[model samples]
Target: MGFAVAIVMCALLIASTTESQHNEAILRARIVTLTAENQRNGVALHARLAACEGGPADLARSRAASALLTPEQRAQHLAANGPQGFDVCARMESADRAVLETLK
Candidate 1:
């Protein structure tokens, strides 16, 4: 009975790890899709923001939101939310290259 319980527990552990890996892969694929979408739509997004011109309300909202994010929170949000929350991905090539490498 003890041996059977140990075997069952081992199987459950393996299943859990497999499920977690599958979920992570799915999330990464989604991030890649979002990145492509962002690239496709970036021009329009920028034009709309630019058209806001000197709208103080829009500018203030942007500023206040920026102020609210800590560096770590920003990083975490970028990883989790992908391009949906972070459409402004004006990051350095080195860092972007690193991410591409890691994702691959």
Candidate 2:
């Protein structure tokens, strides 16, 4: 039963990650249309790719981005990572919770 719960957590993580990926791709594409800077582009892309660990990835991505960016680039990346990212991430989290509840 313990192993079963681990498997379920992994599955839910992957599923929610996929859904969030879809939204991130759409949001990134939309934002890119407004302005295109490959530094922030890479930041956004890398963050989405590393979105598996939830908040930790967000922190790591931000730190990694800071290492590779100027202050202005960091500002753009931070500003860009607002409403769209949160909306989808929150949805993913909600979906994951729903799956766990259903499992119970």
Candidate 3:
């Protein structure tokens, strides 16, 4: 009866180890799937941000906003804020004009 009890305990131990290993494998697979999904979402978000940055609507809005400021005001704002301010369209147009002047 002692031998039988030992054998039963051994069987239970083996079953528990196998179940633990299976659960670990399942968790690893789930982690891999989640990581891949997270990477895909990050890439999609970056692409959307890139599209929005230079999209036509964004450009039009920038132009409309810049039109509210005269060229001299745009220049003064850029001189003060160093081109990263709300005068991005003005900066872009100034750069374009510079390029055109160079070409001429």
Candidate 4:
């Protein structure tokens, strides 16, 4: 009986770990997709701004998008990408910060 219970417990543990890994894989894939989209957006915005075509509407949209990231997410992004990650975070943070400053 004890051995049967131990086997059951081990199976449950393995199942749980497999489920967790599967969920993690899905999340990682999502992150990769989002990151690529964000990079493309950044490039587009940069081009628009360089051409002096980005206006208040662009800024407002950027601010709104930037606000989507929580402070914890911001920290995690910076931590994960090291110094290079700061560039993207800085852009988002600054856009959000500008909006906050205007309200103040």
Clash count list over all predictions? 0, 0, 0, 0
Error of 2 at 33 (Å): 2.3
Task: Find the 10 residues in a row with the least total lDDT in model 2.
Answer: 48-57
TM-score of predicted structure 4: 0.49
Model with the higher TM-score, candidate 1 or 2 = 1
TM-score-based ranking: 3, 4, 1, 2
lDDT of each: 0.60, 0.64, 0.63, 0.63
Residue ranges of candidate 4 with Cα displaced over 4 Å = 53-104
CA lDDT, candidate 3, residue 28: 100
User: Which consecutive 10 residues in model 1 have the weakest lDDT in total?
Assistant: 46-55
Candidate 2 Cα deviation (angstroms), residue 91:
43
What tens-digit string does per-residue lDDT give for candidate 1 at 1-104?
Answer: 99999999999999999999999999999999999987876665444333322245455654465457754454554456343324444343246658779978
**Candidate order by decreasing lDDT:** 2, 3, 4, 1
Expressed as tens digits, the lDDT of each residue in 1-41 for candidate 4 is 99999999999999999999999999999999989987997
The local distance difference test score of model 4 is: 0.63
Error of 1 at 95 (Å): 34
lDDT by residue for model 3 over 1-104, one digit each (tens)? Answer: 99999999999999999999999999999999989987996676444323323345456664566567754554554455443333555555577569769978
